[model samples]
Target chain A: MTSAPPATPVPAGVRATARIRATADGRGGTALPLLTGEGPLALRRTRGEGAEAGVMLVGAMSAPLGGDHLAVEADVGAGARLALATAAATLALPGRGGAPARYDVRLTLEGDAALRWLPEPLVSVRGSDLRVRTRAELAPGARLLLREEQVLGRAGEPGGLLRSRLTVTRAGRPLLDQELACGPGAPAGWDGPAGLAGHRSLGQLLVVDPAFEKAPAAAAVLGEFAAVTPLAGPAVLVTALAPDALRLRELLDAARRTYGW
Target chain B: MASSLAALLVLADGRFPAGGHAHSGGAEAACAAGRIHDAATLAEFCRGRLHTAGLVAAGLAAAAALGLDPAELDAAADARTPSPALRTAGRRLGRQLMRAARATWPAPELDALAAAFPRGAHQPVVLGLTARAAGLGPLDAAHVAAYESVGGPATATVRLLGLDPFEASGVLARLAPELDAVAAEAAAAARRARTEGTEALPAASSPLLEIAAEIHADWPVRLFAS
Candidate 1:
């Protein structure tokens, strides 16, 4: 009989991997889950009331200074539902050789599955170079709600550098594929009228559910600070930038509460 | 060298009448937001954009000049431009550039792109294909893309901030060396892309520029389209 490999210590600075799967219970609901990982990567699932029941946090596998490589692969089976969140703000610090830290997330949603990735802000302190790439594939009727917030640096301090790329697809067509690269000189253009218009913090939220209506209203209300762009599918991309992280957080949280996705 | 370089000059010329005059590359918004107050800040802004968006666009143009697939390059451009407003402006610029290039150069690939996009493709993709039609190489395409990346904004700033046109020109001149380096790197990447695929192209981005472009789009009255 085949068996899972025994756990081993993951060296520092090495990539820690996590895979979580949520399958249909078949009796009429989604199953609990099957999760595996070691090191800085870890997963915590919570059984709350109704929609909050499937919320989970996939975070760093181990404790390290910085420059930890972590991968999270999440699969939500048909008719399954999962709301994913980050345990805390990811603090990116200076690496050993000045190399940036990295995080890679891959999510696949089967037919009729839903995943809400509402992670907290990823704060990049001075001298911190961080890169995050998130790729998601959705079945014909699957749904995904994802958000990414970046704080250039701590309050009153300049941010280091951050490069983030997000690619989302349904069936074989591209719904939304976006990349953002910012660094030490971020405030120059971003703080300008043509760029973030002087905003330091930026937030990107993408929703692919057909039934999600609160976005349109919320987007319309946010006006200048936020702009909503509709995709080919029922999806919509809302991007917002603020002068500080607190304002950006408030803008995003307001949308989150209003949309309730 | 003179003939090919001259053809590139014409394409990169601000007065080429390709609708480039309508867009400021987010400079108008930046100026109004007080991000660019003088020649020094303007230079800094241009330099910042040069390495990020300029580099990315130059790489794509070079790749396109190398005869990479238009659809694939278009998708790459789309992936790089997160702001929907910027995407629309890019295609609009592409359509305008297409009209001029078809009239001036006349290439089968350009025709194919016009047919496929009907609406339009991304600006960098069209720029590369236009360079091919103009008998220019990848380096020339990269130079054109890199130059336009700052040229448009510099001119727009001149008009928006009323900064001295000569000073703005000076900023562009100061950025020339870096622009050359970016174009060279873009050309190198394009050559590599011939074998390594479009993923070899740079995806450097400016999130502030992107987010600002979206906000600028919603302005009830704005001088530039994006």
Candidate 2:
């Protein structure tokens, strides 16, 4: 994959929308963002309707596998009402890549806005080491819903080192966070027989709803081996585990079936 | 006027019903695997975690206490926490803290923030808000931060070490001075603009902790979430 010169940080006002919905090709990638960053992929929320808007990062060009950091400032407008959803990012990666590439997604929710994130699937290529970092905030009564997923390899293909770290916090506090560095022959956390029973691609979904958490329904929506937990009266936490990539997608579809319009 | 002592009493209560008991502070697994042993080693572990995850996370909560943008605080803490299990642990604790704090303090804004960040926020942020709701100042908020970040594991060590529970409580009590000192220093440092990154909260960093946490993630019979 060819790399573009570092991505120049544009001024906050009226930055053009960057929306690339790329898919994974056998050799490397397709339609990924062909660009460079002064340092890494950074998106700062200059301003927007607290709950009505959010910046989307689409990968049109897949760059060399290394460490990539994506920083974001997400503001969930206060008491904005309607349940906004954030799509869980779905990335397709090959395992053969040398070093692990780290991806960090940071969020800040203010006012009374709500957000829900759901993505397709995150596939790690053979021998490739991958890492992901995510941080999100939930302001007062701002409903935040999210699902994180990862696959060892593409359907029927080889998979390798796919390490990752995810941290989620509200009001600068920690609700859910973890770091994993796993490779072939290593036990994937929460995938052992006793953990989640060897699920390959898994997800940890966080839901903030003042009314009913309804964890049972959330798991059914994901359609995989998942555990759901209730927290803080206005919060819901779901841990979904799958045996492979396809199964993980099935679960995401299930979640949409249960909670989405 | 809600006294700081009242807030502390509620926040630090072992049976306050925040589900703090379900967690093993990574100490249980680490100890079971021989990663930590005895009080000296436990002290070492707590100190390391204080700077990395604890300080950084609690710092964000302190920002929230200062009325800094909650979103910024959440993002910074998110950037700091990298583990999925630990991430899950943070959100769970944060959620419960918000729930219990709301019951005691009952602020509309607190309820709103709790709803917005249900699963991903950390414990310090909740403490910051509850401290405010409980009529606590910056110093009191900082104390809550230090205790939530370290006290969980210190208590866990008591069970793991088979040490007297009273001694474990004493160890935590001894930390009061340190907690007070750090909270004071952090409050002093937080007197800055919202744009400035506040790194003085509470955090703990240890590669072994990371490795142990990762290993624990794969355990089917693991005791704690992190």
Candidate 3:
């Protein structure tokens, strides 16, 4: 089995697209029958460990400075399993001529499918404007575990503006619909005690599955920084904000491991 | 003419008793954190809320005022509010606001909505319908929503931080122009929402506010409900 992939930097303004799909193998298992993509996006597949199906490495050559567009789509067939991860953080540089960079992601999960998407943090440099939207559609009995983190600025610097929206639905019913805007002049009161209370880094992890509630140890593993909010449906959202990126990373990693992924 | 404009005043009034006094709109939590220690920062904080959640609320209210289906708007409200705690707070306030609106205007649609979500719909949904029952237009409803978005927080700060009442009032007055601009945009968006569906409404959200509201809800000792 190969180790984790290394970081690569892709140029700005290029649109990258990747698509992966799971298929039923003859041995009562699933395989990545459709794995292909283009542009700055790269995907590396490795053998699965434990009860996993496979692991895919998602990487880019350079930071999406400004005006860059990246689109990623993944599908898990019934009873399949896949874990998607990134090699390094993506920096949101200042917009070239005030055009906000864009990142869009879509995921589809079939019956009894499971996926884990743990992307690296996005560092928003000063004067940068970025827009990111993610949509997830899940069929009955499907499961998804995802995490997202953002740092307003580099160490000793103020952060840029980032507007992100995340929408998840299960069997055509809305499970979670969240929109977050941060950085300079954003609506959220980052300095407020009720808000970030002066935290510069924010992280969120979401778990969508019927089995989520059955596991009683999940909340205990979240620790102090992260707070888990279980919804009325089969979804739970855990959020945390920290004074620095390191703390946020530690908290989210702990949460990531809590799910046993 | 006097009564029509007075209706707007009555709904926008801070003392109208719509259960808004209990919510700092996340301001109490902000103040407790020392993010808003003075008048200047308080103004800035209110400005952020006005443009983001305020604008979104105004848009939803305007759509409701335009006579759109209350149930659809309620669902839209649910979609916009990602925080479970904030959603519960919004619904509670909505119920209180609904009781006040029904008593003040006595409209059948408002009665229908009250029956639909006995627990309560989102506050903006009820606020917009309440404006319609009061003979106000979409723009008027937007103004009420936009102003209250900040108004609740400003007043809450006066109590939480103990800032000068006069100074807080001044902060609101200073925000008049921006508030007007936001209300106008909300009204225009509501006009589009008529044909484009509720998706046309603004979804601007404050991550910190939503997160803080959730955290504050867990606090065993807090002054505000949200």
Model 1 segments more than 4 A misplaced:
A1-12, A48-55, A58-64, A155-157, A184-199, A210-224, A257-260, B1-3, B188-200
The lowest-lDDT stretch of 10 consecutive residues in candidate 1 chain B is B203-212
Task: For model 1, give the interface RMSD.
Answer: 4.1
Write down the TM-score of every candidate.
0.86, 0.47, 0.88
User: For model 2 chain A, where is the 10-residue window of minimal lDDT?
Assistant: A13-22
Query: Model 2 residue B206 lDDT?
Result: 31
Better of 1 and 3 by lDDT: 3
Report model 3's TM-score to 2 decimal places.
0.88
Candidate 1 residue-wise lDDT, A1-261, digit = tens: 589788764444766777888887776656656787767666777674453336456555322235677778889988887877777877777766555678888999999898888887888788777778888999888888888898887888877777777877778555666656676743234343334445668997777875643443322426556766555456767678788878887877777665547
Model 1 has an lDDT value of 0.78
Q: Is the docking of candidate 3 incorrect, acceptable, medium or high quality?
A: acceptable
How well does candidate 3 reproduce the true complex, by DockQ?
0.39
i-RMS, every candidate? 4.1, 10.8, 3.9
Sort by DockQ, top down from the best = 3, 1, 2
TM-score of chain A, all candidates: 0.84, 0.63, 0.85
